[model samples]
Structures are given as C-alpha cells and as structure tokens.
Target chain A: MPSAPAGTLYRGREGMWSWVAHRVTGVLIFFFLLVHVLDTALVRVSPEAYNAVIGTYQTPIMGLGEIGLVAAIVFHAFNGVRIILVDFWAKGPKYQRTMLWVVVGLFVVTMAGFLPRQLMHVFGGN
Target chain B: MAATVPDLAAPRDPYARRKTTRSNYELYGWIFMRASGALLIVLIFAHLWVNLVSGEGVNAIDFGFVGGKWANPVWQVWDLVMLWLAMIHGTNGVRTIINDYAERDRTRLVLKLFLYLAFTVVVVLGTLVIFTFDPCPTDAAADLLPSFCSSLPG
Candidate 1:
C-alpha cells in the first residue's frame, strides 16, 4: 500500500483521522448551534434586534463561513454513519477503510453541488 | 537492592481492569449519534434551503419572515425536532470527549456536570421558546410587534 510522507498526519490510520475529524466537526457544530439558538431567541425580545443580528449574516464574510459550517456538518454526519456501520454491521470492521473513502466521496459530491449555488448567492449582486 | 522505577512510557497491560465500568450506555450513545445525524441532515438542510436558498434568500428574513414560518404548524414541528435532536446529539458527543480525555475522576465529574447543565438549559429554554412563541401579543407594545399582527382584529 502507498504510504503517507514521513512524520506527517498521513501516517495515521483512516479510523484515527476519522475520529479526529469527527471531534473537531462536532465541536464546531455545537458552537454554531449555540450562537444560532441565542440569535433566534432574540425574536422574542424584539423583531428589530432579531433582524439586525441576522442582517450581519448576509455579508460576504459570513457567506464564506456558511460554507465552512456546511462542510463540517457533512463530514461529521458522513463519518458518523461510517462509525455506526463499523459497530453494527457484521462485516463492518473489515471494510472500515473502504467506508471512510466512501464518506469522503459523498462529502465531495455534496459540497460540489452546494458551493456553486451558494457562491452565486453570496457574490451575486443585490 | 537498588530502588526500582516503573517505566512511564511502557505500554499498559491489555488485560488490566478498566477504569470505567462497561455498560450498554455507550452502545446506546453510539446508536443515538447515527440516528440523530440522519435526521439532522434533512432537518438542517431544509432549514437552510428555506431561510437561505429560497426566494430572495437571507435578505428576505426578518421578524415577519420568522413569524410567517412559525404560523404554520409544519414549520413549528420542524424547528422543534431540529432543536431537540441537534442539542442532544451535540451534548452526547461532547460527553464522549470528556469521558475519553478527562483522566481524573473529579475533573470528569465537574466537566460532565457543567455539560449536562448547559444541555438542560438549552433544551428547556429551546422547547419553551418553540412552543410558547407568540408573534403578536396583546401585552406587547404595538411598535415591537410584527406588522401582520397589527392588521389582525384587536
């Protein structure tokens, strides 16, 4: 099998990297959800405040951030299913590496489908 | 005899008793993560499509926009399920992290205590907000209310 470069993260097994990515993505989504809940709750106080807060999200910078959020969520969800298969399926453990590749493929496809439309909306003029 | 020092870097015994108890709790947690993840994809994506991708996109959102959505029972149920599932899934994931990394009993307990506390607060507050939300209130100042609410008979 081909090897990763010496002294690099690539030396780790697919499962290891999957775990690391899962944790990172999970944390990112968690914080994002926290902020999201707080902002949505603002509608109770006043619509003006809620609109003002959401207004900031329409900017170019936030548009880019939305892509990153979507990527993190896709990775986490894909790898999470892989983990479930590994645990539950009779042949799962044997094909975990294959599953990881499948997860990567799906993530790429989904993001590719998403990015163009998102960019048009973001960079598209008012 | 010279004093002997244990090798700190040596591999631990594979057969050693586990520090934490073995239970079906982890099995349940694992299952919950996948189940909630599947649901989140649909819930989250639809939410994004409506709020960010649909006609006029994010700029169209405002108090009235949200009020309009929540006026429908379908959207209300959708938001409620999304809130509960995502919060629980995220909380459990963090709990796993704490269990794996916190070496000390006290540290693990403290961390989990706070984690559960936050989870409780969010879930409780979120559920209340979803179910109890009233866009137009007779008690609220008219200026703060949605324009649609004013159009309704007093």
Candidate 2:
C-alpha cells in the first residue's frame, strides 16, 4: 500500500480513524443482527430445536465471541452518538477529537463492567 | 469608474441552469439514522441487560425464558418495535457502506438486492414469530414449557 504524502486533509487522524472504526463496527453489528434474527426465528420451530441452538451460544467459545460482539456494539453505539453530535451540535466539529477519546473511554468502562460478569457466567459452574 | 459587484448566489450562466428534481429521501435517511440510533441504544441496552446480564446470564436464555418474556404484552411490543427499528437502521447503514465502497453500479445493486432480501425475510419472520409464538406447544414435554403455560387454560 502506498503511504499517504504529508498535508492530506484526512491524514488518518482521529477523525478519519474514528470514521473507519465506525464503518467497520457498523457492518459487523449489522451482519450479527441478521444472524441473531434468524437464530431467534428458530423459536417458531420447536422448543427443543430452539434450546439446542441457543445452547451453542452458552458455550465458552461462543461466550468469548459474545464479548467481542458486545465490544463492537458498545463502540459502535458510542461512536454513533459522536457522529450525531458532530452533525448536530454547534461545537461538535471543534470537539470531535475529544469526543473520540470520550467514546473510547466509555467503551473501556462498559467492557470493564461487562467482562467479569460475563466471564463468570460462562466459566463459573452452575 | 467603480467596478460593479456581482451577486455570489446568482448562477454564472442563466442558460446553463439545471432543473432541480431532488427529493428529500437522502435527507430523511440521514435524520432517520440519528433518530433511530438514539432509540436503539436504549432498546438494545435494555434488551441485553434483561436477556444477557440478568438472572443466569446467557445460561438463563432457554426457550422457556424467551417464552416467559414474550408472554407479557410489554415485552412483545418492545421486541416488535426493536425488531423493526433495528433492521431498518442496520439495513440503511449497510446501504450507505455499499454505496461508499462498491465502485461498480452493478455490484452495489446486487449487494443491496441481497441486503434488502435478508432484511425482509428477517423482519417478516421475526414479526410472525413474535405475534404467533405459542409458549406451550401441545407436543412439547411439560418441563420444557414456561410455568405460565401450565396455568393457561387448554
């Protein structure tokens, strides 16, 4: 990949990186939502069928995957708010960089709160 | 002689003016994303809390658990609204992404065709499942059904 020359407008700064991250997370969450709806639709089948599939979600591997999925969701959600502010707030563009950091900060705090609880649920014996 | 100042807002060439036929579809789409996004944060966060973070967490999410939740009209509406809003939000987001990256028109069309197809299938199926869901199927073992199912008059 060719490196960008100096003085480009975007220059891969916080603004560009945040935008890239938002797009990536948005697409990931959308695909997950598709599969989630399909899996949920299985309730129309039989209870046994539904349980059998949802059971897979309880496994350790999928539990870890859930962490990643939730991480993506949390980031996407916070960054989405940032994007809204950037569009609507009078001072948003000026504070866009600060808001990106705020988004990251909130993501860390949210994951911190969620991780241990989820980890215990997955690994802690019933 | 003083130079005459031209109005910046005026068209450079009156004969070159193009007829405007733009609709506000994209504008509405932009507004919808922000609006739906704010609502979805609340909807999905509550959804995750109740389903994944409460009780036994993921392990608590069995068929009966779902049946129990959907048994309430509140949850039913909550889920129905969530389903519609989330699907539309996600579909529009993906559409934007496709429009951005898909250089070829045909590729964008094909991708969006599949995207809309998936959206329709999921939305329709989910709506049906939410409305028509039977907490207790006749053939299912009694233990597998939600507690409320037993109290339900046969």
**Docking quality (DockQ) for each candidate:** 0.30, 0.62
Please write out the lDDT profile of model 1 over residues B1-154, one tens digit for every residue: 2467755655764676658767788778877888888889889889988987777676667777888888889999999999999999999989989987787799999999998888888788877877888888676666656678889986
Worst ten in a row by lDDT for model 1 chain A? A1-10
Chain A TM-score of prediction number 2:
0.91
Which candidate has the highest lDDT of all? 2
Count of residue pairs whose backbone atoms collide, per candidate: 0, 0
Largest DockQ belongs to which candidate?
Answer: 2
Candidate number achieving the greatest TM-score relative to the actual structure: 2
Q: Candidate 1: misplaced stretches above 4 Å? A: A1-11, B1-23, B137-151
lDDT of 2 by residue, B38-148 (tens): 999999999989987887899999899999999899999999999999999999989998997787789999999999999999999999999999989999998988998
State chain A's TM-score for model 1: 0.89
Give the TM-score of each candidate: 0.81, 0.90
Instruction: Candidate 2: give the clashing pairs.
Output: none
The reply for model 2, stretches above 4 Å from the true place, is A1-10, B1-18
